[model samples]
Target: MLPSITPFGGMNLRPRSSGSGGVEEARNALGQRLRELRRRAQLSGKQLAESLSWQPSKVSKIENGKQTPTDDDIEAWTRATDTEHETEALLASLHTLEVQHAEWQRVLKAGMLGHQLELSEQDAKTRLYRSFEPAVVPGLLQTAEFARALFSRAIMVHRVPNDVNDAVAKRMQRQEMLYRTDKAFHFVITEAALRYRLCAVDTMLGQLDRLVSLTSLRNMRLGVIGYETQYVVDPRHGFMIYNSDLVRVETYSAELNLRQSHEIGLYTSTFEKLAAVASYDAAARAVINRAIADLASAQPEDGE
Candidate 1:
């Protein structure tokens, strides 16, 4: 059954302006919804605060969208205001936005290292990492030159960084998680994906060689899905499936975190379909070797 939503004592009821920036816009929107509900119920902020045993300032922050109300708070507010289904759903969306705007730097220093370190750390802890590569090599297996090329593009073309080398080094440092003694590693690749070179032939060759070496480790598993394979789940975009008592699927825009039983079940089902269509063990190694050979053959000899 859908939950109830009520006007929390502190939220404002006005629509947010278009000029609002960053997280403020989200908070303001949530505030406006709560405010409308409270007014409709003929409850003043002070009166509502009295009912909830909350300080007037707490209610004020919630109404102003400066503070996020908890699920319990929302439930209580909704009950107090006598709200129904649609109102509850609209209010629930605010929780998603608030959770998604994670401060990546803070997460990193707190030991997550943003998504990059977090992905590898989870893989190491769980012994499995299911990856779909639509465009480039997964960061965990990237070589220095290939990694540098990718970083150069981001820093120079995208203007996302001031120091290209520093960024590239950070990326390389993140890869160490894959090799940490405590966790096994599993990687799945596609033949077409491996063929699409991201750097010079030498760089691509080194990357492939690294892949070959890494896959040879007893605890490391590599799988290759050929273009000919028929996939039950034809996921065209790249995503990383992190398995560590939870499943996290990362996209370019947002990281989808799944811990709920139903959500985990869904991702597991999709991952199995992808695995079934992939080639593993020696067959996967052959694909990597072939790509490396093809890259070398295409390049001019060093003496020439």
Candidate 2:
């Protein structure tokens, strides 16, 4: 839980736009269904675990959505509860949860280019895109060179199959939406994000320059929160809200796709809070300029 803090009410907190809810709710729904089945069979959690020769915690975790059940585990559970008929339904929910939280290795199994293309498809149809970053620039605003450095870092960190060139190309292609006048874009980044040099000093300098240039676009709203900006909400991780409906949050293991209205609202609230304190227009450009100058000053030993 986060420490309580007052919120800034200056920025709008309404949902941005539309998107599919992914797994978090599905996991909870599945857990409730399993608990219902257990109750219907007149079995206590301990009794069910004992009958299946599994630890009681396993039953509790599965019932409360703390853990995901295996196929065999589910089979044993249904058989023990005489609810085998529920197997198909349970499996379907599990399947949805698994796909929604697909591990990075599986997502990049076909290499990074595939995911880039998938993102491109989504961006092409999105009417409004809102993104918040605690560190690093959003992909939609990245320069090709900066993206190459970022993807290369991903290859090293995740040890995924490297198709860096193709992936970078596809990512660049996805940036075409910046020119589309029909869609609205709102981006909020923290001072830490501007300071984090994900790329070499030269590339970062260029990236900072790009940010400054992007702010000039009529359809784009870029906000930058300074290092000392007051925090109403902690920016735990970077997230993007697509069309005000779907929120996508990436962590070390999986990308969380949030579709529930309250979940999306929570993110929307955070985005607005961050935006309220963020510098915009000339102020935003000054932030980028300051970053560029700092990067340039450090370029002697950092350009790679």
Candidate 3:
């Protein structure tokens, strides 16, 4: 979410979702440390790049937290800076951030079902949960059938173990958190999400109905941004902001846990802007009704 920490080619990097900005802060600190080392060694960026057989800008990017340093890069940097004594301490900090990133492969090493349980645990702890979706229904408001289709798709795409049923069950269990009075939920979705057709017409209609049903809950705020509304901010990827502490964003290849305050605040502002242009209450129901109407029309004629 804070731009990607690494390039797209190889196994990647991630930020912290704990919301204390620990990962981001540490990255910035690492960059500062690297820069201090370079300055202390009286080496220019160009000189270091030439010495390491790397691009000059890479040295600058790593020193500014715009890019993450690989282990090899770290080693090379320390050696170039004549700070070999600091390598262990610096790598220790990097490892702290690495574990928090939760690379998808490592996370799914056990199974997808466990991932759902892990999120369920997070659900139990969150006091205020805000989900902003541009493409699909948020899990907290998904129907059992719709959720099944999603898990099944994940199995096919990610090639994770085929534990769709268990994953579905765990998701439904997480949905129970919505009924808690002490916690509050806010959902902002584009109308396009409802029409994405992730499930059959009937199943999606049921999902839409579920959306309408949840609207009556006092603590839940459901907002649908219809096409009719003018642009607020250019919509980006979907993200879940947990109590102003952390933001979780899923990409095609990985899940990003954004812990930086500025990044979290940016999403909060984006959600509010999207919410401002969204249709709520009765107007929101009308939008849902329209989607349901279209789905019904796509069904076969009754007489046939």
Highest TM-score against the true fold, candidate: 2
Per-residue alpha-carbon lDDT of model 3 for 1-304, expressed as tens digits? 2222111111122223334255557778889999999999999999999999999899999998877787888899999988999999889877766654555665676667777877877777799998877778888788989888776666666677788778778778787778889999989888888787666888898999999998888889999999788967866657788998878776555566776778788879888888788888899999999999988998898798
Report the lDDT tens digits of candidate 2 across residue range 241-272. 89976777665555556767878887888789
- State the TM-score for model 1: 0.61
The TM-score, computed over Cα atoms with residue i paired to residue i, of candidate 2 is 0.79
Judge candidate 3 against the unseen true structure and give its global Cα lDDT, from 0 to 1. 0.77
Using all chains and alpha carbons, the TM-scores for the candidates as numbered come to 0.61, 0.79, 0.74
Task: Point out the worst 10-residue segment of candidate 1 by lDDT.
Answer: 2-11
Superposed by TM-score, candidate 1 places the C-alpha of residue 277 at a distance from the truth, in angstroms, of 2.4
Q: Using TM-score, rank the candidates from best to worst.
A: 2, 3, 1
Task: Give the whole-model CA lDDT for all candidates, comma-separated.
Answer: 0.61, 0.76, 0.77
lDDT of 2: 0.76
Q: Candidate 1, overall lDDT?
A: 0.61
Provide the lDDT at 152 for model 3.
67
TM-score of 3: 0.74
Lowest lDDT block of 10, candidate 3: 3-12
